[model samples]
Target: MLRRLFGDWRPTVLDVLLSLAVGTAGLVESFGRQGSQPGQIGDPVPMAAGAVVAGTMLLLRRRFPVTLLLALIAVGLAVRAVSGGGYYAAWHFYSTLILVHTVASSTEPRSRRGFAGLACVLAAYAFVQTFQHNDVAELMIGAVFVGVAYGSGILLRRQMDQTLRLAERATRLEVEREARARRAVAEERARIARELHDIVSHNVSVMTLHTGGVRMRLGDEHARERDMLLGVEQAGREAVEELRLMLGVLRGTGAPGSGALQPGLDQLDELVTHVREAGLDVRLRIAGEPRPLPPGLGLSAYRVIQEALTNVLKHAHATGADVVITYGRTGLDVEITDDGTGGGPDGPGSDGHGFDGHGSDGHGSDGHGLIGMRERAAMHGGELSAGSVPGGGYGVVARFPLEAPVGVR
Candidate 1:
């Protein structure tokens, strides 16, 4: 309830209650039979009007603190007019201090300072008026409350500034995190695109060449084989044309030149052989219904696997690592994990940023190649993730969607 009154500029239940309480108390004191002399009592009409104005202005102070300050000045003058130079009700002093605090807490530093100065002048004027009437008690009470109100206002303002600073800092950190990730992805994607272009172009060109060579070798007697080879040759040529068209979109988005011929799964055995020869015991596991993959996808899968194994060999420092490829109905999943116990270059407990930074933690984990892997998967409408795995090792996983070949289903 108090928060609503202090923290915002809306009409709140507490504002309503305070308005009613203060207005009613002031009115009752003005009109009710008091011990003061008859001449001290104010005219009923103007005093009642002042009470209502005071209550309404106080209720609106959150939204218009400055305006309320101005209104409080006017209302005090009206009440004083009716009192005929006699003492005013305590409610007038109470309302002035409350509005002063509201303006102090909510206004900007410059405006608050200006308003507070004017308010103190007016408060001193009111206190002097009371002092002349021999009311020392009211002056002392008003002084203490004004000081307390100013203290609380300053504290709340500092708290508000601190909260704003923290919020801005958090927002800036989030933006930096996202931009860092985006730069990584763009770099890797451009490279992946160039690699894809090289892969598909070479594979299709080879197929077209082989088909044409075989067709030329066939004699006129074997008309059926010649016709089949011719058809294959035509298809391969069309595929090359299509590949060229597809690569138009990928041309400008390239990184450095890749190997002349990107290796596919057919080269995995040789890769594994070299790793084993380097003294790393690596195991390969393949599951799912294996089928011939598109040139780009096959090369992409091979690259993902190769990168993982190379990281394990260079960074994992473990005796053994495992690679798994699972072909699903819609896509294939590749996962590589290492024990990190091999006392290798990166040593144990080192994890890469697959969300791992390559070689940052000596595990070639998280932030390492994450953007590239993500781009590769994204090329095929897929995704990738890498990070520390359970049992003191690191893992990288990538998924790529595959389209079944025409007439194969």
Candidate 2:
């Protein structure tokens, strides 16, 4: 609560209350001391009025600090002049000291030094008036008191300046850290893109060229082989197109091939055909009416299914597979299952049966493929899970919201 009141470097209710309390106490002490000194009793009303004025002026100290301090100092001098210069009362000294501290702490360096000098002069004048004998020890004590208040204010100002500098440094460091991380990510992505370009472009170009050469040499005499070669060539061309799209995405460019859209659920049939050509029996089933999904959501769903089917082909040793897509009011759910042992000859739990003997972590033994699928689903506020099915197969399932998050497109 104190921090909240004073944190902004402005006068508040607490400041007003503190001023009133100190002013009232000082007024009462001055009046009480007047009674103890013979013939020193003066007009209580004027003294009380002066205290009230000085205390009320404290409210504007933060906004008009120099003006208020100067006003208070003039009032003190006027009171001393009127009282025949014997000694200023305790309340007068208290108000003067408070104002001196405020001026020193709130003003700029030149102003603070000027105020401190003026305060020292006033302290010397008061010491001379109160101690007519000119005692050196008494003058030195008054000088030290004035110096302490001014020094304390200077110390506080320095501390505040240091705090601000440290805060700025911390903010700069945080910004630099974030910039470094972004640079690292961009560099890594570029490296991966270059490697992918080298591998995919070389292999796909070779496959497409060989398939085309074989198809041309066979002519119509070997129609079956020629037709198969044509399929191979078509598949190679599709792979190249897909690689271009992926490269464009990696490089932050739009999809390639005359603004063609990224592959989505609409391309699932072609994906299944490619897998079938590789000797895997797969069927796709849709349970509800399909709607136009956000591009990112559609793409994520397509990738999950593609990864699951590829896993089935390479690792599940499955003869047949089923791909089920259910579109509901809220979201879409995809399930890919295979009716074969959940392992290949080199895979875990490959005892010619299922993954019954393997642990739960066996599903993730296929490198980062499953992890990548899960990340894709999660990026769209969805989930993916894979495991061995109960009867004699493996299954991969993913769920995604129909409406992609904002900015995903």
Candidate 3:
């Protein structure tokens, strides 16, 4: 508490009160000693006046320390001249020591050195007085007290400076840590994006070529199958286009083409259709008015839905799934659920399909699809969660803010 009260080294009400007490006590002592010796007495009024001046000057010491010290010194000289040079109060010396300490601790090095010289002059004057009175012991004690006060002030000042420097260093380290983390996240995102581009681009290109070949061989004899192949080919083309757009974003390119736009809620129906063609009955239900969304947020939302549906087709043995999209003024929410076997189509013993059990053989079955979906969501300031539902199915849900952060595009 004392440190808090004096931490700034500024004078406050408490300082004023303490100075008042010291001045009053000194005045009382001077009065008490007036008749102690034949010619050692001084006028009570001049002594009290000097003490009052010293205490009043102390109040302004923090703001105008050098000026206050000079004023106090002048008052001390005037009081001695008025008193005929034989008497001095202990509190007067104490007040001078306090001022000396304040100057040492608060001023710049050059100003402090100048004040130290003035203080030495004052000390020498006092010493000369002590010598005239043959009070060697008193002189030694006063000198030691002043030296200690000044030394303590210098130490405190250095400690405070060091504390400030340490605090600044800590802040700098925290900033550097955050910068490093952001760089790592960006690098990881770019790496994942490149891998996705390679995988999806190759698979989609092959699917498009095969579909076109099948349709050509059929030659309109089986219109229905040819139409289905045509639909698949169109979906593959769209997927390739969207992938290109996403790659452009990941690679920090402005856009893949002059008129290209990131796929969003508008293309959700086509996405569901593609999954249905893959042998999973999927339905999309959207709630709320459809409006324009930020490009990044839209892409993230579309990818999340795509991954969820893909998982359903690959693992869920059930014949149907549902996707619900609810849009709010500030955000969008998506939920996808399937009625397939809660674990996998192949039952409990099966570790599901995929390389590591994420979903598809191309990916992993552990949770790669979910992880990628979640990363996409989070990149746009969103969140995603996936798990088996209580009754008997797997579900995935995601929420995204409507507005993208500035500079996201």
Q: What overall lDDT goes with each candidate model? A: 0.71, 0.67, 0.70
- TM-score per candidate: 0.66, 0.50, 0.52
Q: Highest TM-score: which candidate? A: 1
Clashes, model 1: 24
Q: Give the 10-residue window scoring lowest on summed lDDT in candidate 2.
A: 354-363
Model 3 earns a TM-score of 0.52
Model 2: per-residue lDDT, tens digit, 297-395?
Answer: 776688778777776776677899999999877789999999876545444544332221211112232234554566667777899887768897878
Cα lDDT tens digits for candidate 1, 1-409: 9776567557789789879988898778667734456545635656667878888887886787667777777777766765665666667767777776776677655675556655653554464365245467866766677767656765787789899999999999999878877766665665566667677678778988998898899899989999998999899889878876665565545523344787778778898898899898999999987788877888778877777777676655677889898988778899988887434333345453223455222223245455556666778888888777777787888999877656657
On lDDT, the leading prediction is 1
Give lDDT tens digits, candidate 3, residues 163-275: 99999999999998577555555554674465557556766788899999989899656999999999999999999898877877776754223223446678988888888
Off by over 4 Å in 2: 1-9, 34-36, 81-87, 108-134, 198-203, 210-214, 217-409
- The alpha-carbon RMSD values of the candidates against the true structure, listed in the order shown, are 7.1, 14.6, 14.3
* Candidate 1, run of 10 with poorest lDDT: 359-368
